[model samples]
Target: MLVLKKVQGGESGLEATDLELVQRCLSGEQEAFAEIVARYKKLIYSVVYNIINDKQEVNDAAQEVFLRIYKSLDRYNPEYKFSTWSAKIATNLCLDILRKKKLDHVPIEEIKEVSSRLDTPEDEYINKEKSSIINQAVSELPDKYRIPIVLFHQNGLSYEEITEILKEPMSIVKNRLYRARLILREKLMPRRKEEVL
Candidate 1:
């Protein structure tokens, strides 16, 4: 059995690298694969939720992503970062789900509010409203623009990693991200003005 002991202030406090976990998992240690799920479940959920935008579908899609990951472990390349590879799988799966369902206008109200210290309930409400507006704008974005922005900003993937996952040229990834930002700015500017007024 592969055991992971907790340590302070390091990557999930697990001593084993992702490759090590995968190796152990391949060696028939089920716990190692469980550990991998525990480590990355939040990430997979975030990627799926951002794309699928429906809370009901997010859970099913995330579960399916993990199942796919487990089945494809043998094809995992040691040269690449495991998180990147797994994110690519999640992204592709979510996209496939979207294509199959032909979903339109999914609401994004389920997006978690970013917590911060607020001096008053009014401030908290304002913050949440702003976040909701932002998420709404993001959800309205075209998929070509939305996917790159979500992977880059929301998921914190690097341009190179996104390029790899998206199989687009570096210039295309950068361009899409830039255009997404511009579109978001345009979408949010009127809201900002209304608040000021």
Candidate 2:
């Protein structure tokens, strides 16, 4: 096991390496597994939340993701990054949940209400409003485009990575992402013009 030291303010603190932690967990260390959960719970939850709008469903999906990961750890390829593998699991679980559920288009007013909670400067608020419009537009997109957009834009994944996660060809990933952006532009244009006028 590797114990890494962090130098903050010239004081060294110990940090456990992810691989070491994984190995320990594989060797039946419950605390190590807990550490892994602590490290990745938010990531898994965010990925699930992006696809599943319902908070309860998101929580359930996140739990399913971790359980699947735990069971399949022996099958994980060490060559790929752990986050990438975990993200694939999360994305797949979310897709499964989405497929099982009936989706409702989120109302723009609901988006406005959600965004209104944060008090920011006027310019920031305007920007956030614009962003909310864009989000609504994204939510309206067909799954083909929406999945790629969330994976590439929100999750910061590469086209190749998205291809692996979605089991689509690289060409398809690129095309979907491009089409998603174009659709968002078309959807937001009228609102943009209204704001200008």
lDDT of candidates 1 onward, in order:
0.83, 0.74
Q: Per-residue lDDT of 1-197 in model 1, one digit per residue for the tens?
A: 33354222236664677888888878898877888987888889888988887787888889999999999999999888999999999999988988898865333433445566544788777777777888888888888898988888888899989988999999999999999899999999998899899
TM-score of each: 0.87, 0.81
| Pairs clashing within candidate 2 | none
Q: Which sections of candidate 2 miss by over 4 Å?
A: 1-14, 104-120
Model 1: CA > 4 A from native = 1-14, 104-117
Poorest lDDT segment (10 consecutive residues) of candidate 1:
1-10
Please give, for residues 1-197, the per-residue lDDT of candidate 2 as tens digits. 22233212213545666676677778897777777777778777767777776775777788889899889877878777777788899988777766776564421222233454665798577767777777789889988888788878777788877888888999889988888789888888898799789
Error of 1 at 145 (Å): 0.5
User: Residue 70 lDDT in model 2?
Assistant: 87
